[model samples]
Target chain A: MIDQTALASAAALLGESWTPWLVVPPGLLLGLIFGAIPGLSVPIAMAVFLPVTVHLDFLSAVLFLTSIFTGGGFGAAIPAVLMNVPGSSSAVATTFDGHPMARQGRHSEALGLALAASCAGSALGYVILLLVVGWVADAVLLLGPLEMFAIAAWGLTLIAVLHEGSFIKALLAGLLGVMIGMIGMSARGDMRGTFDSLALVDGIPVVPALIGLFAASEMFRLMRRDYIVEDKELRRPAFSRILAGVGMALRHPLVVARGGLIGIGVGAIPGVGAAVANLLSYAETKRRAKDPSVFGKGEPRGVIASESANSSSEGGSIATLLALGIPGGSATAVMLGAFAMHNVTGGPRFISENLDLVYAIILGNFVQVVVLAVLGLGFLFFAASLVRVPLRYLIPGVLLLALLGCFSITGDMMGPITMVVFAGLGYWLREHGFPVAAVVIGLLLGPAAESELLRSMQVSGGDPAFLLQRPVATAVLLLLVASLFYPLLRRRRRA
Target chain B: MQGQRGSEVALLLLIAGFAIWLAQDAARRSFSFENLVLMVPVAGLILLLCGILAVAALRRAPQEAGGGLARVLGLLALLGGLVAGLETIGFDAAAFLFLLAATALLGERRPLVLLAYAGIMTFVIIMTLGFMLPYEMPTLLLDPPR
Candidate 1:
């Protein structure tokens, strides 16, 4: 599997005068800062900087973009650790334990564990990608529209049933999310639920909706308190404690490895990337843990599970993009554009012709992990202080920033309106014991699932037996059934 | 506790009603196995889930009174107003008013300090989002004369 000439070419590129010493570091920082802020995501950063990459050589441009990709995988966990807010959907599960840890005065430790797990996971993802890209390329082709739809449905069902709420409420929330996600024009050019508004043509802007659902809603809940953490002693962050947290993360090798595997598997699937990967990994980790009740109340393993999965998902997304020329998510979509800009096609032909470049991209990501660790340490020193900011000031500041960020997303009043509307809805739903995570996941996966289902029906001419032809889709449906009942079985066993 | 149950029921009904409306719309658009664009099955599933939830809510025993309902609703009202006013009065002015109201509600007593904080915040947001980035926010105060 190892191509020696390609390895040498990768090494030669790394040895270039400007590649390692200057370009990659700044890209990582930009990605970190952009990703750490609510409303700004890795994809947004990549899109913003895509024009700038036009000036550089193909290798340099890819190196820069990949660094951002690597840095963003961890940077998104920052807000999730300190505040209850997840900067992006991928970090939603991270907030379950990361924020609780912050409340327990272990914010530094949570950040440290997240950082270490992210680094490990990213490296593992790349390793898997490098080794199995060729093999997986063939398997991906077998996964037709029905298989894809089944996979999404399975993920959403698992997430919904795993919520703390009543199973009915959870399922309702998820279904509602799917319905809401189908707000725009359908794949067949038929409008479903846009209410005849031009702005609704593009569907609800998800990042803004995410910001409102998590950040704004959480901030409203936190407003009554003086600070994120009440204890003055716990507010002070020490480098030693951070190191100890890193040690703690290192101790949980099994959790980290499991999370990385899950990340790679789910992330490899188009449209279902880090966002669902982190949620599924966290749910699995909690289900398997001896003290599952402690999960939402500040468990280091929870942070490790989510961070590792979300980070590793980056590598998985990259694999699909490279081997098949199919972008897994928005970030890879931007990368596909970058590929076009550089006149580098990314299918089988590109892999055969530029195997060296493929190796180079993977190698650059491995190097990015080490550099991310160093920069991330400096970032933590400043980030841990955020808990000390009074809630009165912090609430308005974050809301304002979120509003501005949302505005930037749609470039209109729709952004602010979406934030306001979703914020209210999220608070109410959360208060009523509806799992907001399930809803968000449903929204994210709905369009893809709907499109796939429609395509499958079209392909089969509406024959129900068409599903029998696809073994992968059948297997996925079986897994979905098993996952739904597993929780009930476990509860019965415990009883 | 009773109030919470009532609110939950109301939410469930709202969802069920919306699902019914969606199904009706799909029927108008030619709901069938052939019309792949008709997401009627999803709407039907939502209705079924809502029905299950409503039944569950009725059977489950309610407990514990919550106090922050008013606070949440108040904040939401302010947020709604802020969003509605953004395009009309502009983001800066609307955001400034929102900040002032939100801070005051959160118990910031000092009047001058509130004014300064809201003003500075609005200015920074406009500058950062409108001027620095390519984000196009409506701004009566900052826009060049037509």
Candidate 2:
């Protein structure tokens, strides 16, 4: 499977250009900045800088874009760790334990672990991509609407896994989220819960709603405290702790490897990218762990699982883009535009004709992972200072930033309005022992599940027996059922 | 304990009401297969979940302690006001006022500190974000010409 001649040519092509090297740092920095902010997403960052790529050669442009992709992958975890505000949907699982670690004054260490896991996951994804890019395209083709719906259902199982308090309440919250997610115009142009507002025509903007539920709600809770880190002595940033955190992550190589594998597999699916990948990885890790109870309470392994999966998903997504010309998510969609600008279509024909370039792109991402680690450390060093700021100041500052960021997202009042509304809902949910994360999972997967199920019903004419013909979907559903019941079986056995 | 249970019941009722409304709306919009496919089942599930939770809430003893309700509400109200003020007063003015009031609400006592912090941050955040973002943000004081 290794094309030695093409690999050598790719190496030569990369070596021929110094511009690509120069663009990597800036691209990574831009991605870090964008991904660190609550509402600014990787796709927005890529779209903003896409026009500038016109000046560079194709290799340099691709390198620059991928560097941003790589950086944003880890960049999102920063706020998730520090403020409990996941910068993107992909980082939602990162906040499960990362913010708890921060509150414990382990912010530096959490950031360190995130950086390490991200670098490793990205590298692992590219290595897998290098091995499977030739056939991954064909493999992805087998996933139809039924299969996609099953994958989404699999993601929704996270609501069950995230339940630590009242399972009933968690399920209620998750169902609420699903209902909210299904609000607005349906596929057949029928409106449900839009309240007759024109803005609801598109649907509730997910990112802004995310900001409200996680970040803004958390801000309200933090107002009771004086600073992010309760212990004043532990608020100082420690470079040593960050390094130790990296060492801690290194000790959990198996967890990182498992997360990377899951990331690649899940991320390869369209409409279900890093967001689902990270959650699935976290849920799986939590489920498999000896002490699953410690998961949401500053578990280092939680950070490792989430960050690794989200970062590696970049490689998985890039694989689909390169092999099938299909963008996995919005970020990859922007990359597809860059491809179009360069007069390069990304299909099997393109990959077969330009295998060397594909190899070069993968190889370049490997280098980016190394650079990301170095840059991420420096970025974390500064970001870690967030703990020292008094909550009185930090709360308003960050809340305002989130409001502004949401405004930027929707280009109207809808973003901020949705955020504020969800903030209230989120706070109530949290206060009532309802898992906000469950609600988030529901919101993220509900629309996709609904659309895919609708498509499947249309294709199968609503026949229940149609599932028999689709073995992949059947297997996935079986796995979902097994995962749901496994804990009950284990508990009974232990009892 | 009674109050807490009442609140929980109220929340459950609210959710149940929402589900009922959604189901009615979907059906009213012409019970087309596409419209009812996801909504009907989701709304039904929500009602079922709400029933279970409400029943459980009534049976369970209240054991959780509550505090910071006032602060959370104050902050939430301020946040709501900030969003409301954005289009009316513009981002810059609205943000500065929000920062000032929120800082005070959070217990910042020094008047000079509040004013300076709010003014500087408002300017810095708006100018920086305005410079970085591609779209135009409406601002009373710092609305730059396109």
Chain A TM-scores, one per candidate?
A: 0.95, 0.98
lDDT of 2 by residue, B26-78 (tens): 78976887878777887888888888888888898865547788888999999
Per-residue C-alpha lDDT of model 1 across residues B50-117, encoded as one tens digit per residue: 77777777777875546766777787888888878787888778888889988888888999999999
| TM of chain B vs. native, candidate 2 | 0.88
Chain A TM-score, cand. 1? 0.95
What tens-digit string does per-residue lDDT give for candidate 1 at A104-208? Answer: 899999999999999988888888887887666777788889998897776776555357747777777878887778777777666666677889887888878
Query: What's each prediction's clash count?
Result: 0, 0
Where model 1 places Cα greater than 4 Å from the true spot, the runs are A18-20, A463-465, A482-495, B34-65, B140-146
Clashing pairs in 1: none
Tens-place lDDT per residue, model 2, A304-330, is: 999999999899899999999999999
Q: Which residue pairs collide in model 2, if any? A: none
Question: Which stretches of candidate 2 lie above 4 Å from their native place?
Answer: A493-495, B59-65, B143-146
Q: Quote the positional error of residue B23 for candidate 1 in Å.
A: 1.6
